[model samples]
Structure formats: structure tokens, C-alpha cells
Target chain A: IPPPMRPIPCKPLFFDLAGNHISYPMDEIEEKAGTSKKSPKKEGGGITGLVKGLWGWGGK
Target chain B: MTTPTAAQQKKEQEKQALYVELQKFCQSQDDTRAIKVASKILHLFPNDEVAFKTKIVCHVNRGMFAEALSLINDTSKLSGSVQYEKAYCLYRLQRMEEAKSVLDSWQSNSFKKVELMYQIHYRLDNFESAYDSLSDLLKTSDDEMDDERRTNLSAIAASLKLAGSSRRVKDIQ
Candidate 1:
């Protein structure tokens, strides 16, 4: 009997996500709750906190 | 008996505050903090669905499969997605039989469930079931992941046609 040829590799999933690791669909839980990537509305927030968080203005 | 209205409102407000914190932790991808906040929410409101889910997902992201599985078992009447989580935890724990059992009870033919089924079967060396799952994925897959799915399908078919698995490539095809 002839030997069967080895198969090629499949495309990678998730591409090295830090926490999720693989394409585990972990975010589906948040998405269904209408909460994925969206922060709860904070009161009286303008641009100060955003800038500080973005560039570490005060911490650095 | 009903509680006083003001107290009830205060409790509601408290729950909202914890839930909002949980949401913030999730947004930041601070999974450990998310788990802690979610545990707080669940302690306060045991029936909070999103809190339960958030905690479970955090456990998984941290590779705490055993913890996630224990929590899933202790809870009652899990949602379909949560049931999938249970199966996933079992699979990650390398308990293939229990994982397959959980998946066998799954009613919906969701893409996630099918993909997981394929993985579990593959891990158990059940190539036939894996082949069938890949076929199902091929039939229902969107363009977003069709290429990967096809590659997996061909790989499974090729391996099965060999002496390792009894099923022929033509049989799976």
C-alpha cells in the first residue's frame, strides 16, 4: 500500500491575543450584554481624564 | 414580605455601582480585577447573569479551567452559552468524555458549539466525529473563516484516508 501524503497546516486563530490567547469567543459574552468595549457612562467627564489615561500625564 | 422602598432603592443602587465597576474592569481587559468585581456582584446579586458570565470568562482567560468548571457545576440551569463554557472547561481540563457529554446535550447547532465539538473529538482521537464536525463547519461557515475551516477539513480528510484512521478521504468527502 502507498503511504498517504501529510497535510498542510491550517491558518492561525486569534494571532496571539494576550488574555484570550486563542479565538475563544470570550467577548461574545460581553457583546450579548451590550457591554463589549463600551464603558459605563461616567458623570461629568470631559477630556482631562481621557488625556491622563491616554498619555499618563500625571503618573509619569 | 417586601422590604422598605428606600432600602430597596439603595440596594439597587449598590448593585448598579458594582455592576458598573465590573463593566469597567471588563473594558480595561483587567481580567483578574474583572473576576474580583464579578464575584462581588454575584455575592450581592446571585442571579446576575452577566456577572456570572464575566467571572467565568475571566477564569478561562486566566487558564483557571478547574475553577470555572467547579463554578459551572455549582450553578443551576445554565444558559446555552454557559453550557458551552462548561464543555470548554471540561475540554481544557482534558476530560474528554465529560466534555463530549456536555456538548451532546447541546440543542443549538451554533458555530461555536460545532467548532468546539470538532476540537473535543479531535483531542479524543475520534477522527470520524471530527471530520463530520469539519463538514458541518464547511457547510455553515461564513467567508470570515472559510479558508481556515477548509484547510482543517482537508487536513482531517487526508489524515483519515491514511492508515491511522479507518475512514477514507472519499468517505469523509
Candidate 2:
């Protein structure tokens, strides 16, 4: 029987504008996405946590 | 019909000689020399097919993607090969979405097209789709597969394996 499929944890590789291969670290990407070092979960004071803390009553 | 004048005959002979020289340079893979001769030919016959193709190839080999793309744009009634080169230039410029769109529009089944499609899907994070395209390409007769194709197939397969193993390990942990 064929082996069960699994998702790969490989970093995505991209060709730069000059056709050069490049890959970015996941943490650096997440940081750029505003969810790593400064994530609300980490800081416990961002908009995400604030909303969660206030529950749905914070806003519709 | 009147016979050709001596001057016209001489000009035709010179053109033919230039074409022969261009063919030799191209066959030798001396792109720089080929470009020089091709430019001269283009100077005399602005729309010469051989000269145009040679110039575009020289530009591509020199990594002048923007120049190649511009030349392709300036051309009218693009041939299939020219369209393929245009798509290739877009791809090399890291315009993945646009490259994919251009490639999709072409209906021919060619090695370059398959290779480009694999790259586009792989870059889009569609690994399975990428693998599918690659496997389809590999299914062609061995005689038709060149060294580059073989290398690409192996590289992608190895990468897929590594990804799969890492995912499985994470699951186990």
C-alpha cells in the first residue's frame, strides 16, 4: 500500500526578479506579518488580545 | 522578366554570406559574435526572422531579460517560440502570476513549458500540483528527456521527500 500523505514543512522557495532563488525564514516572515515578537499573545496588549479579552461585547 | 542587375546580385550575395556567417556563429554557441552579425543583418533587413530570433536569444543568454521583453513587445505577429521566450523573460523577472497566465495561454506541449509550469506551481506553494506537472513531464520517453530535465526531476523529488519526512516527524513529536 502507498504511504499516507503528509504535509511538507519545507520553506517555500521563490525566484527573485532576477531569476535568483531565494527563501525567507518563517520567523522573519511572521515578524513581518506583525505576529511574531510583537504578537498580541506575546505582548498581551495588542488589538487582538484586547478584543478577545473584552469578548464579543467589545464590538459587533 | 528582366534579368537581375549586377549591383542587386552582389547585394544578394553579401546578404547570403552574412546569413551563413550568422548560422556558423549560432551553431558554435558564440552568442556574442552571433549578436554582432545578427545586428548587422537587422540593420539591412529590419524584419529578418533569423536576425530577430538570434538577437533575442543573445539577449536572453546574456541575462538581459528586460531588453528581451522589450524586443518581444516591439515585434508584431509573434511566433510560438517568441511567445515562449516572452513568457520566460517574465518568469525570470520573478513575475510568477503573470508568467503563469502567459504559460496557460499557450497550448503547445513543450519541454520548456512543462518546466516553467512546474516552477510556477512550486512557487505558488502548490506542491502536489507541482509534482503532478513534473511527473507528467517525466513520463515522456527517456530519449526525449535531457540532462537538465533529469536534474530538475530529481531535485524536486528530493525536496518533496524532505518536506514529507519533516512533516511526518513533526506529527510524531
lDDT of each: 0.67, 0.61
DockQ of each: 0.07, 0.01
**Largest DockQ belongs to which candidate?**
1
Poorest stretch of ten by lDDT in candidate 1 chain B? B163-172
lDDT of 1 by residue, A1-60 (tens): 989989875532311111222222344444433434544334225777555444323221
iRMSD per prediction, in order: 7.0, 20.9
The TM-scores, one per candidate, come to 0.69, 0.60
Q: In candidate 2, which residue pairs get closer than 3 Å at backbone N, Cα or C atoms, i.e. clash?
A: none
lDDT of 1 by residue, B53-169 (tens): 778888887889899888888887544448878888888888989989998998867667778888777677677888887787777666665666666666666656652676656
